[model samples]
Target: MKASHFLFFILLLCICIPASAQEAKMKKIFNGKNLKGWVEPANKACWTVSDGVLLVKNEPAKKGAILWTEKSYQNFIFQADFMMGDGTVDSGIFLRSENDQIQIGISGSLKRDLTGSPYIPKLRYPVEATGVKDLLKPKDWNTLKIKVIGNTYTAYLNGQEVMTYSSADMPPSGPLGIQLHPGNEMSISYRKIMAVAL
Candidate 1:
């Protein structure tokens, strides 16, 4: 083989390798059949799987729970489809730790729908996501996509970019969680829970 041809081939391989590696990193975190890859909450009855959907409802005690991933993720793209159910739905997706969360339903403290916004404990909500009020389908399935890199978070609702915020207090890495806020007789369903490491 010619020397120049060999060099060109090597360069092409270098570019393609990273792309392939990224694709391989894509994973379906939720198996749909059960919570195999997640750390089940203390009240297992609060979370259940039916027809490939992961459902969460308030327990009789009104004590909420958080379903966390068994493994931790640093930087990644997380996506899931959620359908709001009865009562005042209140839930969120915990980014790296419980402190940093993406609000999925109504904010308990705010007393309104703050979907797609970041809810930081103590700090509260630094910024609210726009277009959520118009894009959200209250009775139907809505897709929520979050990209977390470093300390920045960008949220997309139904494939439209809505909000981006940088957090100085977010941890470097931790397990992701799905929240079931207490004191509410509500239920929510999630499907197609996936993440791809960056």
Candidate 2:
């Protein structure tokens, strides 16, 4: 063809290549059928899979549990859709380690919905998430997206940028975890759990 057309074609290919490569990096961490990649807890009855959604509830004794991934991740983008269930729904997504977590439902200590906020051990909530009051849907499904790079954590709720925090004490690498806060007698459902390494 013409020289100008050939040059334009090459430029388009360069731009499209990176976009396609990035999409391929994303993988489904949860198979939606079973807990194959996660480290199963002793109380299997507390966690269940139904209709491709992973449901978590407190055991009969009210003891909480954490469903953690077997593999540890460094810097990545994690996304999941969660629906708040019955009772005092206090749950979170633990990043890197249990020390740094993103609150999903009510805060046990604060006794209020702290959804989309970062909960750090010892330091508690260093900063509250903005627009969480309006962004969170009480009984419906909400999307949570977390981007982790080094010590900084950025959170998006329902596709809106909600909060960002930097932790000096965050572990460099650790497995991700979903928490069913102990003694809450709460329940939550999670689906479309995915992550992309950066």
Candidate 3:
């Protein structure tokens, strides 16, 4: 083979190798068929899967539900598509268990749309995300991506960087969870859930 062709081949190989490896590192935590790798802290009836979407519905008869991952992660990137059914739906994506969470919908009483905000429940207040109000789709699906590295947390909404925060009290490792706030009658759906551990 020609020297120029050989050099070009080597360059392509180098670029493709890492991209392939990075893709391989990602693991799909949710299977569309069932709740195989998740735990419902409250009850099974609160959570359900249908037609490739994971639905968390508020149950008036039961307490608030949190669906947690079976496996824990230290540093990882989470990707998912979420949408609210209707009205004011309160929900969030819990990081490293229930201590830390990223707000996905509105909060009750406060009536604030804090999507993309990184907050510590029952502890510190939420750090509001910028450019989130314009990006959020109330009646449509929105893409969310979160990257947690050590104490740093970064969030992206609809392919745009929404916010980044650092916390000293962040846990070293834990499972991720999706919350279904009780009391109010609301429903939230999630699909294409995946994670890549770093």
Best by TM-score: 2
Order of the predicted models by lDDT, top scorer first: 1, 2, 3
lDDT of 1 by residue, 124-158 (tens): 99999998989999999999989899999999999
C-alpha lDDT values of all predictions = 0.93, 0.92, 0.85
- Candidate 3 global CA lDDT score: 0.85
Q: Tell me the tens digit of each residue's lDDT in model 3 across 4-58.
A: 9999999999999985786578788998889998865647887889999998887
TM-score of each: 0.88, 0.89, 0.86
In the range 32-67, model 2's lDDT, one tens digit per residue, is 999999999888899999888999999879888899
What's the candidate order when arranged by decreasing TM-score? 2, 1, 3
On the 0 to 100 scale, the lDDT of residue 19 in model 2 is 59
Q: Model 2, residue 169: what's the lDDT?
A: 93
